[model samples]
Target: MTISDYASLLADAGDYSGRDDVAHLFPRFLALAELKLNRVMRVADMEKTATVPLAEGEGSLPAAFLEARQVLGADGRALRALPLQEFNSNGTSAGAPIGYAIVGAAIRVRPKGGENIRLTYYAKIPPLTAEAPSNWLIEKAPDVYLYALVEEIAIWERDAAKAGAAEALKRQAMAGLGLADERLRWGNAEIVIGGLTP
Candidate 1:
Protein backbone atom coordinates (compact mmCIF):
# COMPACT_ATOMS: atom_id res chain seq x y z
CA MET A 1 0.00 0.00 0.00
CA THR A 2 1.03 3.57 -0.56
CA ILE A 3 1.81 5.98 2.25
CA SER A 4 -1.46 7.78 1.62
CA ASP A 5 -3.41 4.59 2.00
CA TYR A 6 -1.49 3.67 5.15
CA ALA A 7 -2.09 7.15 6.61
CA SER A 8 -5.76 6.96 5.79
CA LEU A 9 -6.01 3.63 7.56
CA LEU A 10 -4.23 5.04 10.58
CA ALA A 11 -6.59 7.98 10.61
CA ASP A 12 -9.52 5.60 10.50
CA ALA A 13 -8.09 3.73 13.49
CA GLY A 14 -7.58 6.98 15.32
CA ASP A 15 -11.15 8.01 14.66
CA TYR A 16 -12.38 4.66 15.93
CA SER A 17 -10.41 5.15 19.13
CA GLY A 18 -11.64 8.75 19.49
CA ARG A 19 -8.15 10.03 18.78
CA ASP A 20 -8.95 12.47 15.99
CA ASP A 21 -7.32 15.15 18.08
CA VAL A 22 -3.97 13.52 17.28
CA ALA A 23 -4.52 13.14 13.58
CA HIS A 24 -1.63 15.48 13.03
CA LEU A 25 0.62 12.81 14.53
CA PHE A 26 0.00 10.16 11.91
CA PRO A 27 3.29 10.85 10.15
CA ARG A 28 5.14 10.42 13.40
CA PHE A 29 3.39 7.11 13.92
CA LEU A 30 4.49 5.92 10.51
CA ALA A 31 8.06 6.90 11.21
CA LEU A 32 8.01 5.10 14.53
CA ALA A 33 6.68 1.93 12.93
CA GLU A 34 9.45 2.05 10.32
CA LEU A 35 12.04 2.46 13.04
CA LYS A 36 10.71 -0.55 14.93
CA LEU A 37 10.60 -2.62 11.77
CA ASN A 38 14.19 -1.73 10.97
CA ARG A 39 15.24 -3.07 14.32
CA VAL A 40 13.29 -6.34 14.22
CA MET A 41 12.69 -7.30 10.61
CA ARG A 42 15.49 -9.05 8.67
CA VAL A 43 13.85 -10.45 5.60
CA ALA A 44 15.56 -10.87 2.22
CA ASP A 45 14.04 -7.71 0.88
CA MET A 46 16.34 -5.72 3.16
CA GLU A 47 19.53 -7.38 1.89
CA LYS A 48 21.89 -5.14 -0.11
CA THR A 49 25.36 -5.45 -1.63
CA ALA A 50 27.77 -2.56 -1.91
CA THR A 51 31.42 -2.02 -2.75
CA VAL A 52 33.04 0.17 -0.12
CA PRO A 53 36.43 1.80 -0.62
CA LEU A 54 38.74 1.49 2.37
CA ALA A 55 41.45 4.07 3.05
CA GLU A 56 44.19 2.78 5.36
CA GLY A 57 42.09 -0.30 6.20
CA GLU A 58 39.16 1.78 7.42
CA GLY A 59 35.99 2.60 5.53
CA SER A 60 32.53 3.93 6.15
CA LEU A 61 29.56 1.64 6.02
CA PRO A 62 26.75 2.36 3.59
CA ALA A 63 24.36 5.07 4.70
CA ALA A 64 21.45 2.61 4.90
CA PHE A 65 23.43 -0.25 6.42
CA LEU A 66 21.73 -2.09 9.26
CA GLU A 67 23.99 -5.15 9.81
CA ALA A 68 26.71 -6.82 7.84
CA ARG A 69 26.07 -10.33 6.50
CA GLN A 70 29.40 -10.85 4.79
CA VAL A 71 32.51 -8.93 3.74
CA LEU A 72 34.75 -9.95 0.85
CA GLY A 73 38.16 -8.73 -0.25
CA ALA A 74 39.15 -7.40 -3.66
CA ASP A 75 39.93 -10.96 -4.75
CA GLY A 76 36.56 -12.20 -3.37
CA ARG A 77 37.93 -13.91 -0.26
CA ALA A 78 35.55 -13.75 2.69
CA LEU A 79 36.81 -11.74 5.65
CA ARG A 80 36.08 -12.78 9.21
CA ALA A 81 34.27 -10.60 11.71
CA LEU A 82 36.38 -9.71 14.73
CA PRO A 83 35.62 -8.12 18.08
CA LEU A 84 36.65 -4.50 18.35
CA GLN A 85 39.10 -5.21 21.17
CA GLU A 86 40.77 -8.04 19.27
CA PHE A 87 40.96 -5.93 16.14
CA ASN A 88 42.43 -3.02 18.08
CA SER A 89 45.00 -5.23 19.81
CA ASN A 90 46.13 -6.52 16.42
CA GLY A 91 47.81 -3.13 15.86
CA THR A 92 48.14 -1.20 12.65
CA SER A 93 50.16 -2.60 9.77
CA ALA A 94 49.55 -1.80 6.11
CA GLY A 95 48.62 -5.08 4.42
CA ALA A 96 45.57 -7.08 3.27
CA PRO A 97 42.66 -7.24 5.72
CA ILE A 98 42.02 -10.66 7.33
CA GLY A 99 39.18 -9.57 9.59
CA TYR A 100 37.00 -6.56 10.32
CA ALA A 101 35.04 -4.95 13.12
CA ILE A 102 32.32 -2.39 13.00
CA VAL A 103 33.47 0.72 14.83
CA GLY A 104 30.62 3.15 15.09
CA ALA A 105 29.38 3.89 11.58
CA ALA A 106 32.64 2.82 9.95
CA ILE A 107 34.31 -0.55 9.31
CA ARG A 108 37.86 -1.10 10.62
CA VAL A 109 39.95 -3.76 8.93
CA ARG A 110 42.95 -5.53 10.39
CA PRO A 111 46.42 -5.07 8.85
CA LYS A 112 44.94 -1.98 7.28
CA GLY A 113 45.42 -0.87 3.70
CA GLY A 114 43.35 0.86 1.06
CA GLU A 115 41.19 -1.31 -1.19
CA ASN A 116 37.61 -1.73 -2.30
CA ILE A 117 35.70 -4.39 -0.36
CA ARG A 118 32.31 -5.87 -1.19
CA LEU A 119 29.83 -5.90 1.66
CA THR A 120 26.56 -7.74 1.86
CA TYR A 121 24.33 -6.33 4.55
CA TYR A 122 20.83 -5.75 5.69
CA ALA A 123 19.70 -2.25 4.84
CA LYS A 124 17.05 -0.18 6.51
CA ILE A 125 13.64 -0.32 4.92
CA PRO A 126 12.93 2.77 2.88
CA PRO A 127 10.65 5.01 4.88
CA LEU A 128 7.28 5.88 3.49
CA THR A 129 6.70 9.53 2.63
CA ALA A 130 4.61 11.75 0.43
CA GLU A 131 7.17 11.61 -2.39
CA ALA A 132 8.04 7.93 -1.86
CA PRO A 133 4.73 6.43 -0.91
CA SER A 134 5.57 2.72 -1.13
CA ASN A 135 8.36 0.21 -0.46
CA TRP A 136 8.90 -3.53 -0.67
CA LEU A 137 7.38 -4.19 2.75
CA ILE A 138 4.34 -2.06 2.06
CA GLU A 139 3.87 -3.69 -1.35
CA LYS A 140 4.39 -7.26 -0.16
CA ALA A 141 3.01 -7.06 3.39
CA PRO A 142 0.60 -4.20 3.83
CA ASP A 143 -0.90 -5.92 6.86
CA VAL A 144 2.45 -5.68 8.64
CA TYR A 145 2.53 -1.92 8.09
CA LEU A 146 -1.09 -1.48 9.13
CA TYR A 147 -0.71 -3.51 12.32
CA ALA A 148 2.57 -1.82 13.22
CA LEU A 149 0.97 1.59 12.81
CA VAL A 150 -1.89 0.50 14.99
CA GLU A 151 0.56 -0.56 17.67
CA GLU A 152 2.21 2.85 17.56
CA ILE A 153 -1.14 4.56 17.83
CA ALA A 154 -2.00 2.34 20.77
CA ILE A 155 1.22 3.32 22.50
CA TRP A 156 0.52 6.99 21.92
CA GLU A 157 -2.93 6.55 23.39
CA ARG A 158 -1.37 4.90 26.44
CA ASP A 159 -3.70 1.93 26.11
CA ALA A 160 -1.72 -1.12 27.13
CA ALA A 161 -4.40 -3.61 26.14
CA LYS A 162 -4.75 -2.17 22.67
CA ALA A 163 -1.03 -1.91 22.26
CA GLY A 164 -0.51 -5.54 23.21
CA ALA A 165 -3.21 -6.68 20.81
CA ALA A 166 -1.79 -4.65 17.95
CA GLU A 167 1.71 -5.90 18.70
CA ALA A 168 0.50 -9.48 18.54
CA LEU A 169 -1.08 -8.91 15.17
CA LYS A 170 1.97 -7.12 13.90
CA ARG A 171 4.22 -9.98 14.94
CA GLN A 172 1.94 -12.48 13.25
CA ALA A 173 2.09 -10.49 10.04
CA MET A 174 5.84 -10.22 10.31
CA ALA A 175 6.11 -13.97 10.77
CA GLY A 176 4.19 -14.46 7.57
CA LEU A 177 6.64 -12.17 5.83
CA GLY A 178 9.54 -14.19 7.20
CA LEU A 179 8.02 -17.46 6.01
CA ALA A 180 7.51 -16.03 2.54
CA ASP A 181 11.12 -14.93 2.40
CA GLU A 182 12.32 -18.35 3.54
CA ARG A 183 10.28 -20.02 0.83
CA LEU A 184 11.82 -17.76 -1.76
CA ARG A 185 15.30 -18.53 -0.50
CA TRP A 186 14.90 -22.30 -0.15
CA GLY A 187 12.19 -23.31 -2.54
CA ASN A 188 11.21 -26.97 -2.49
CA ALA A 189 14.45 -27.95 -0.86
CA GLU A 190 14.68 -31.16 1.12
CA ILE A 191 16.41 -31.20 4.44
CA VAL A 192 19.32 -33.67 4.85
CA ILE A 193 20.85 -34.85 8.10
CA GLY A 194 24.61 -34.31 8.20
CA GLY A 195 24.73 -34.53 4.41
CA LEU A 196 24.21 -38.31 4.60
CA THR A 197 22.81 -40.24 1.65
CA PRO A 198 19.38 -41.81 1.96
Candidate 2:
Protein backbone atom coordinates (compact mmCIF):
# COMPACT_ATOMS: atom_id res chain seq x y z
CA MET A 1 0.00 0.00 0.00
CA THR A 2 1.05 3.57 -0.59
CA ILE A 3 1.00 6.53 1.75
CA SER A 4 -2.29 7.71 0.34
CA ASP A 5 -3.80 4.28 0.82
CA TYR A 6 -2.68 4.27 4.47
CA ALA A 7 -4.21 7.71 4.94
CA SER A 8 -7.49 6.45 3.56
CA LEU A 9 -7.43 3.55 6.00
CA LEU A 10 -6.75 5.94 8.86
CA ALA A 11 -9.71 8.08 7.86
CA ASP A 12 -11.95 5.04 7.67
CA ALA A 13 -10.81 3.62 11.00
CA GLY A 14 -11.03 6.92 12.84
CA ASP A 15 -14.23 7.90 11.02
CA TYR A 16 -12.60 11.19 10.18
CA SER A 17 -14.28 13.68 7.89
CA GLY A 18 -11.99 13.11 4.92
CA ARG A 19 -8.56 12.05 3.70
CA ASP A 20 -7.18 15.57 3.41
CA ASP A 21 -7.15 16.04 7.18
CA VAL A 22 -5.52 12.70 7.71
CA ALA A 23 -3.20 13.11 4.75
CA HIS A 24 -1.30 15.91 6.43
CA LEU A 25 -0.80 13.77 9.52
CA PHE A 26 0.25 10.63 7.70
CA PRO A 27 3.93 11.51 7.62
CA ARG A 28 4.03 12.21 11.33
CA PHE A 29 2.28 8.98 12.26
CA LEU A 30 4.35 7.04 9.77
CA ALA A 31 7.52 8.43 11.26
CA LEU A 32 6.42 7.40 14.72
CA ALA A 33 5.52 3.90 13.53
CA GLU A 34 8.85 3.61 11.72
CA LEU A 35 10.74 4.58 14.85
CA LYS A 36 8.87 2.02 16.90
CA LEU A 37 9.34 -0.75 14.38
CA ASN A 38 13.02 0.01 13.96
CA ARG A 39 13.55 -0.39 17.67
CA VAL A 40 11.44 -3.50 18.13
CA MET A 41 12.61 -5.74 15.30
CA ARG A 42 15.58 -6.52 13.09
CA VAL A 43 13.96 -7.62 9.86
CA ALA A 44 15.71 -8.80 6.74
CA ASP A 45 14.79 -5.60 4.97
CA MET A 46 16.78 -3.61 7.49
CA GLU A 47 20.09 -5.32 6.65
CA LYS A 48 22.70 -3.38 4.70
CA THR A 49 26.32 -3.97 3.73
CA ALA A 50 28.81 -1.39 2.57
CA THR A 51 32.51 -1.19 1.77
CA VAL A 52 33.98 1.89 3.37
CA PRO A 53 37.57 3.11 3.62
CA LEU A 54 38.86 3.92 7.08
CA ALA A 55 40.80 7.16 7.19
CA GLU A 56 43.04 7.75 10.20
CA GLY A 57 41.25 5.10 12.29
CA GLU A 58 37.68 5.99 11.34
CA GLY A 59 35.09 6.06 8.58
CA SER A 60 31.62 7.48 8.26
CA LEU A 61 28.61 5.20 8.58
CA PRO A 62 25.82 5.28 6.04
CA ALA A 63 23.24 8.02 6.51
CA ALA A 64 20.48 5.51 7.27
CA PHE A 65 22.53 3.34 9.64
CA LEU A 66 20.68 2.35 12.78
CA GLU A 67 22.81 -0.46 14.28
CA ALA A 68 25.82 -2.50 13.36
CA ARG A 69 25.67 -6.23 12.54
CA GLN A 70 29.33 -6.95 11.84
CA VAL A 71 32.52 -5.54 10.42
CA LEU A 72 34.97 -7.58 8.34
CA GLY A 73 38.36 -7.02 6.80
CA ALA A 74 39.28 -7.89 3.21
CA ASP A 75 40.02 -11.47 4.36
CA GLY A 76 36.35 -11.83 5.34
CA ARG A 77 37.20 -12.50 8.99
CA ALA A 78 34.95 -10.83 11.53
CA LEU A 79 36.36 -7.80 13.33
CA ARG A 80 35.49 -7.63 17.00
CA ALA A 81 33.10 -4.83 17.99
CA LEU A 82 34.32 -2.75 20.90
CA PRO A 83 32.87 -0.10 23.16
CA LEU A 84 33.65 3.55 22.40
CA GLN A 85 35.96 3.96 25.39
CA GLU A 86 37.96 0.79 24.64
CA PHE A 87 38.26 1.67 20.96
CA ASN A 88 39.41 5.17 21.80
CA SER A 89 42.18 3.77 23.98
CA ASN A 90 43.29 0.82 21.79
CA GLY A 91 42.56 1.76 18.16
CA THR A 92 46.07 2.24 16.80
CA SER A 93 47.72 -1.17 16.73
CA ALA A 94 49.72 -2.12 13.65
CA GLY A 95 48.34 -4.48 10.94
CA ALA A 96 44.63 -5.19 10.27
CA PRO A 97 41.92 -3.86 12.56
CA ILE A 98 41.04 -6.27 15.38
CA GLY A 99 37.90 -4.39 16.40
CA TYR A 100 35.64 -1.41 15.70
CA ALA A 101 33.52 1.08 17.63
CA ILE A 102 30.63 3.16 16.50
CA VAL A 103 31.21 6.72 17.72
CA GLY A 104 28.81 9.39 16.57
CA ALA A 105 28.20 8.92 12.82
CA ALA A 106 31.58 7.31 12.18
CA ILE A 107 33.11 3.92 12.91
CA ARG A 108 36.53 3.94 14.57
CA VAL A 109 38.75 0.92 14.01
CA ARG A 110 42.10 -0.21 15.36
CA PRO A 111 45.21 0.28 13.20
CA LYS A 112 43.40 2.72 10.96
CA GLY A 113 44.50 3.35 7.43
CA GLY A 114 42.98 3.91 3.97
CA GLU A 115 42.11 0.21 3.63
CA ASN A 116 38.47 -0.62 2.89
CA ILE A 117 36.38 -2.76 5.21
CA ARG A 118 32.97 -4.36 4.76
CA LEU A 119 30.33 -3.09 7.16
CA THR A 120 27.10 -4.96 7.70
CA TYR A 121 24.37 -3.21 9.63
CA TYR A 122 20.69 -2.63 10.05
CA ALA A 123 19.46 0.55 8.42
CA LYS A 124 16.48 2.70 9.33
CA ILE A 125 13.42 2.24 7.19
CA PRO A 126 12.73 4.98 4.71
CA PRO A 127 9.60 7.03 5.26
CA LEU A 128 6.73 6.77 2.83
CA THR A 129 5.44 9.76 0.86
CA ALA A 130 3.68 10.50 -2.40
CA GLU A 131 7.04 10.98 -4.06
CA ALA A 132 8.59 7.97 -2.35
CA PRO A 133 5.48 5.83 -2.98
CA SER A 134 6.14 2.82 -0.72
CA ASN A 135 8.45 1.06 1.79
CA TRP A 136 9.14 -2.46 3.04
CA LEU A 137 6.63 -2.19 5.85
CA ILE A 138 3.94 -1.26 3.36
CA GLU A 139 4.79 -4.16 1.09
CA LYS A 140 5.28 -6.71 3.88
CA ALA A 141 3.00 -5.83 6.80
CA PRO A 142 0.81 -2.88 5.84
CA ASP A 143 -1.74 -3.59 8.55
CA VAL A 144 0.94 -2.83 11.13
CA TYR A 145 1.30 0.65 9.72
CA LEU A 146 -2.45 1.06 9.32
CA TYR A 147 -3.18 0.13 12.92
CA ALA A 148 -0.30 2.23 14.21
CA LEU A 149 -1.60 5.34 12.46
CA VAL A 150 -5.14 4.63 13.53
CA GLU A 151 -4.10 4.35 17.16
CA GLU A 152 -2.26 7.64 16.99
CA ILE A 153 -5.15 9.32 15.24
CA ALA A 154 -7.61 8.06 17.80
CA ILE A 155 -5.50 9.48 20.62
CA TRP A 156 -5.35 12.80 18.82
CA GLU A 157 -9.14 12.89 18.42
CA ARG A 158 -9.59 12.00 22.11
CA ASP A 159 -11.91 9.11 21.37
CA ALA A 160 -11.40 6.52 24.05
CA ALA A 161 -13.47 3.80 22.37
CA LYS A 162 -11.81 4.24 19.03
CA ALA A 163 -8.38 4.34 20.63
CA GLY A 164 -9.10 1.07 22.39
CA ALA A 165 -10.12 -0.64 19.18
CA ALA A 166 -7.11 0.73 17.36
CA GLU A 167 -4.83 -0.42 20.15
CA ALA A 168 -6.14 -3.98 19.86
CA LEU A 169 -5.58 -3.99 16.14
CA LYS A 170 -2.10 -2.63 16.65
CA ARG A 171 -1.26 -5.44 19.05
CA GLN A 172 -2.54 -8.05 16.64
CA ALA A 173 -0.46 -6.60 13.89
CA MET A 174 2.57 -6.51 16.14
CA ALA A 175 2.17 -10.20 16.95
CA GLY A 176 2.01 -11.00 13.28
CA LEU A 177 5.11 -8.91 12.72
CA GLY A 178 6.93 -10.80 15.45
CA LEU A 179 6.02 -14.11 13.89
CA ALA A 180 7.18 -12.95 10.50
CA ASP A 181 10.46 -11.72 11.92
CA GLU A 182 11.09 -15.02 13.68
CA ARG A 183 10.36 -17.04 10.57
CA LEU A 184 12.66 -14.89 8.52
CA ARG A 185 15.42 -15.08 11.09
CA TRP A 186 15.24 -18.84 11.51
CA GLY A 187 13.96 -21.01 8.75
CA ASN A 188 11.68 -24.01 9.27
CA ALA A 189 14.26 -26.70 9.86
CA GLU A 190 14.95 -28.83 12.87
CA ILE A 191 18.50 -29.81 13.77
CA VAL A 192 18.99 -33.28 15.12
CA ILE A 193 22.10 -34.89 16.53
CA GLY A 194 22.54 -38.44 17.70
CA GLY A 195 25.69 -39.54 19.43
CA LEU A 196 24.96 -41.92 22.32
CA THR A 197 21.92 -43.89 23.38
CA PRO A 198 20.78 -43.55 26.94
Candidate 3:
Protein backbone atom coordinates (compact mmCIF):
# COMPACT_ATOMS: atom_id res chain seq x y z
CA MET A 1 0.00 0.00 0.00
CA THR A 2 1.17 3.54 -0.73
CA ILE A 3 1.83 5.84 2.19
CA SER A 4 -1.58 7.40 1.74
CA ASP A 5 -3.46 4.14 2.19
CA TYR A 6 -1.47 3.42 5.32
CA ALA A 7 -2.15 6.94 6.58
CA SER A 8 -5.91 6.63 6.60
CA LEU A 9 -5.63 3.61 8.86
CA LEU A 10 -3.44 5.45 11.37
CA ALA A 11 -5.55 8.63 11.30
CA ASP A 12 -7.81 7.02 13.87
CA ALA A 13 -5.24 6.07 16.52
CA GLY A 14 -6.80 8.45 19.04
CA ASP A 15 -9.99 6.44 18.83
CA TYR A 16 -8.05 3.38 19.97
CA SER A 17 -6.15 5.29 22.67
CA GLY A 18 -9.23 4.65 24.82
CA ARG A 19 -7.56 1.37 25.71
CA ASP A 20 -5.70 1.74 29.00
CA ASP A 21 -3.21 -0.90 27.92
CA VAL A 22 -1.42 1.28 25.35
CA ALA A 23 1.86 1.14 27.21
CA HIS A 24 1.77 -2.59 27.86
CA LEU A 25 1.21 -3.31 24.21
CA PHE A 26 3.96 -1.12 22.74
CA PRO A 27 6.51 -3.77 21.85
CA ARG A 28 4.10 -5.88 19.89
CA PHE A 29 3.05 -2.82 17.99
CA LEU A 30 6.67 -2.13 17.19
CA ALA A 31 7.10 -5.60 15.79
CA LEU A 32 3.93 -5.32 13.81
CA ALA A 33 4.96 -1.86 12.63
CA GLU A 34 8.29 -3.27 11.57
CA LEU A 35 6.48 -5.95 9.64
CA LYS A 36 4.32 -3.36 7.98
CA LEU A 37 7.32 -1.28 6.93
CA ASN A 38 9.14 -4.37 5.75
CA ARG A 39 6.52 -4.56 3.08
CA VAL A 40 7.77 -1.13 1.88
CA MET A 41 11.21 -0.66 3.46
CA ARG A 42 14.05 -3.11 3.77
CA VAL A 43 14.28 -5.14 7.00
CA ALA A 44 18.05 -4.64 7.44
CA ASP A 45 17.62 -0.91 6.96
CA MET A 46 15.15 -0.35 9.80
CA GLU A 47 17.56 0.78 12.49
CA LYS A 48 19.00 3.95 10.89
CA THR A 49 16.21 4.83 8.52
CA ALA A 50 13.47 4.69 11.17
CA THR A 51 12.49 3.37 14.59
CA VAL A 52 9.58 1.24 15.63
CA PRO A 53 7.84 0.45 18.93
CA LEU A 54 10.84 -1.36 20.44
CA ALA A 55 10.37 -1.61 24.19
CA GLU A 56 11.35 -5.14 25.21
CA GLY A 57 12.94 -7.63 22.93
CA GLU A 58 16.26 -9.35 22.19
CA GLY A 59 18.15 -6.16 21.38
CA SER A 60 18.65 -2.88 23.20
CA LEU A 61 17.93 0.71 22.21
CA PRO A 62 20.15 3.71 22.81
CA ALA A 63 21.62 3.75 26.32
CA ALA A 64 20.50 7.29 27.21
CA PHE A 65 16.78 6.51 27.13
CA LEU A 66 17.06 4.13 30.11
CA GLU A 67 18.79 6.76 32.21
CA ALA A 68 16.43 9.63 31.42
CA ARG A 69 13.36 7.61 32.39
CA GLN A 70 14.42 7.48 36.06
CA VAL A 71 14.29 11.25 36.52
CA LEU A 72 12.15 12.66 33.74
CA GLY A 73 9.52 9.92 33.52
CA ALA A 74 8.71 8.57 30.07
CA ASP A 75 8.20 12.01 28.57
CA GLY A 76 11.86 12.87 29.01
CA ARG A 77 13.16 9.93 27.05
CA ALA A 78 14.19 11.22 23.61
CA LEU A 79 14.83 9.37 20.35
CA ARG A 80 18.13 11.19 19.63
CA ALA A 81 19.83 8.92 22.14
CA LEU A 82 20.27 6.61 19.21
CA PRO A 83 23.04 7.16 16.65
CA LEU A 84 23.60 7.36 12.89
CA GLN A 85 20.16 8.58 11.97
CA GLU A 86 18.59 9.08 8.52
CA PHE A 87 15.14 10.37 7.53
CA ASN A 88 12.35 9.98 5.02
CA SER A 89 9.25 12.14 4.67
CA ASN A 90 5.94 11.03 3.12
CA GLY A 91 3.93 14.21 2.80
CA THR A 92 3.54 17.97 2.54
CA SER A 93 2.57 19.25 5.96
CA ALA A 94 3.76 22.54 7.41
CA GLY A 95 4.51 21.36 10.95
CA ALA A 96 6.35 18.35 9.65
CA PRO A 97 9.94 17.94 10.71
CA ILE A 98 12.37 20.08 8.75
CA GLY A 99 15.77 18.96 10.04
CA TYR A 100 14.98 16.88 13.11
CA ALA A 101 14.69 13.11 13.09
CA ILE A 102 11.38 12.01 14.50
CA VAL A 103 11.02 9.04 16.79
CA GLY A 104 7.91 8.02 14.90
CA ALA A 105 5.74 9.66 12.27
CA ALA A 106 2.04 9.94 11.54
CA ILE A 107 0.98 8.23 8.32
CA ARG A 108 -2.19 8.81 6.31
CA VAL A 109 -3.01 6.71 3.28
CA ARG A 110 -4.90 7.68 0.12
CA PRO A 111 -6.09 5.24 -2.48
CA LYS A 112 -5.24 5.92 -6.11
CA GLY A 113 -6.91 3.63 -8.57
CA GLY A 114 -6.77 0.72 -6.12
CA GLU A 115 -3.22 1.62 -5.08
CA ASN A 116 -2.82 3.07 -1.60
CA ILE A 117 -0.29 5.84 -1.07
CA ARG A 118 0.97 7.34 2.14
CA LEU A 119 -0.42 10.87 1.92
CA THR A 120 1.23 12.50 4.88
CA TYR A 121 3.45 11.46 7.75
CA TYR A 122 3.82 13.43 10.97
CA ALA A 123 7.35 13.29 12.27
CA LYS A 124 7.51 13.06 16.08
CA ILE A 125 11.02 14.01 17.07
CA PRO A 126 12.39 12.68 20.33
CA PRO A 127 13.34 15.26 22.91
CA LEU A 128 17.02 16.04 23.22
CA THR A 129 18.64 14.97 26.49
CA ALA A 130 21.59 16.54 28.20
CA GLU A 131 23.30 13.32 29.23
CA ALA A 132 23.09 9.58 28.81
CA PRO A 133 20.18 8.06 30.68
CA SER A 134 21.06 5.26 33.11
CA ASN A 135 17.86 4.18 34.89
CA TRP A 136 16.43 2.35 31.94
CA LEU A 137 18.49 -0.69 31.00
CA ILE A 138 18.37 -3.41 28.43
CA GLU A 139 16.55 -6.32 29.99
CA LYS A 140 14.72 -9.39 28.87
CA ALA A 141 10.99 -9.09 28.54
CA PRO A 142 8.84 -10.37 31.38
CA ASP A 143 7.06 -13.64 30.74
CA VAL A 144 3.78 -11.88 30.03
CA TYR A 145 3.65 -8.72 27.91
CA LEU A 146 0.35 -8.52 26.06
CA TYR A 147 0.37 -7.81 22.31
CA ALA A 148 4.17 -7.87 22.75
CA LEU A 149 3.89 -4.11 22.21
CA VAL A 150 3.18 -0.99 24.19
CA GLU A 151 3.24 2.78 23.64
CA GLU A 152 0.30 3.62 21.44
CA ILE A 153 1.48 6.42 19.17
CA ALA A 154 0.03 9.80 19.96
CA ILE A 155 -2.70 10.23 17.39
CA TRP A 156 -1.37 11.26 13.98
CA GLU A 157 -0.93 14.98 13.98
CA ARG A 158 -0.75 16.31 10.45
CA ASP A 159 2.66 16.53 8.79
CA ALA A 160 2.81 20.24 8.07
CA ALA A 161 6.39 20.86 6.93
CA LYS A 162 7.39 21.19 3.31
CA ALA A 163 9.82 18.73 1.69
CA GLY A 164 13.36 19.50 0.42
CA ALA A 165 12.63 23.16 0.91
CA ALA A 166 13.12 25.70 3.63
CA GLU A 167 11.56 29.03 4.43
CA ALA A 168 13.34 31.83 2.62
CA LEU A 169 16.11 33.50 4.61
CA LYS A 170 15.99 37.28 4.32
CA ARG A 171 19.05 39.46 4.26
CA GLN A 172 17.25 42.40 5.89
CA ALA A 173 19.18 43.59 8.91
CA MET A 174 17.53 44.31 12.23
CA ALA A 175 18.85 45.93 15.41
CA GLY A 176 19.11 43.45 18.24
CA LEU A 177 17.80 44.51 21.64
CA GLY A 178 18.62 41.41 23.68
CA LEU A 179 18.80 38.33 21.49
CA ALA A 180 21.17 35.46 22.25
CA ASP A 181 22.48 32.69 20.00
CA GLU A 182 20.44 29.52 19.55
CA ARG A 183 18.06 29.80 22.47
CA LEU A 184 16.39 26.67 23.82
CA ARG A 185 13.78 26.79 26.51
CA TRP A 186 11.80 23.97 28.04
CA GLY A 187 8.60 25.12 29.63
CA ASN A 188 5.26 23.56 30.45
CA ALA A 189 6.54 20.26 29.15
CA GLU A 190 7.46 21.47 25.69
CA ILE A 191 10.60 22.69 23.94
CA VAL A 192 10.54 26.19 22.54
CA ILE A 193 13.35 27.20 20.20
CA GLY A 194 14.39 30.63 18.95
CA GLY A 195 17.35 32.83 18.26
CA LEU A 196 19.05 34.26 21.31
CA THR A 197 19.81 37.95 20.92
CA PRO A 198 21.68 40.25 23.22
Please estimate how well model 2 matches the true structure, expressed as its whole-model Cα lDDT. Answer: 0.76
lDDT of 3 by residue, 72-182 (tens): 112223222222233333223332222222233221211101121111122221211223111110011110111111121321212123110111100011001001111
- Where's the lowest-lDDT run of ten residues in candidate 1? 1-10
RMSD (CA, Å), candidate 1 to true, equals 2.8
After superposition, the stretches of candidate 1 with alpha carbons farther than 4 Å from their true spots are 1-21, 190-198
What's the CA RMSD for each of the models?
2.8, 3.7, 22.4
Q: Candidate 2, residues 11-87: lDDT per residue as tens digits? A: 55345322346667767776776777778667778899999887787799999999889899867879998877777
TM-score of each: 0.88, 0.80, 0.17
The sequence of per-residue lDDT tens digits that candidate 1 reaches over residues 128-175 is 776676688877888788888888888987999999999999999999
**Candidate 3: misplaced stretches above 4 Å?**
1-17, 42-198
Clashing residue pairs in candidate 1, if any? none
Which pairs of residues clash in candidate 2, taking residues 3 or more apart in a chain or in different chains? none
What TM-score does structure 2 among the candidates reach? 0.80
Alpha-carbon deviation at 186 in model 1, angstroms: 1.5
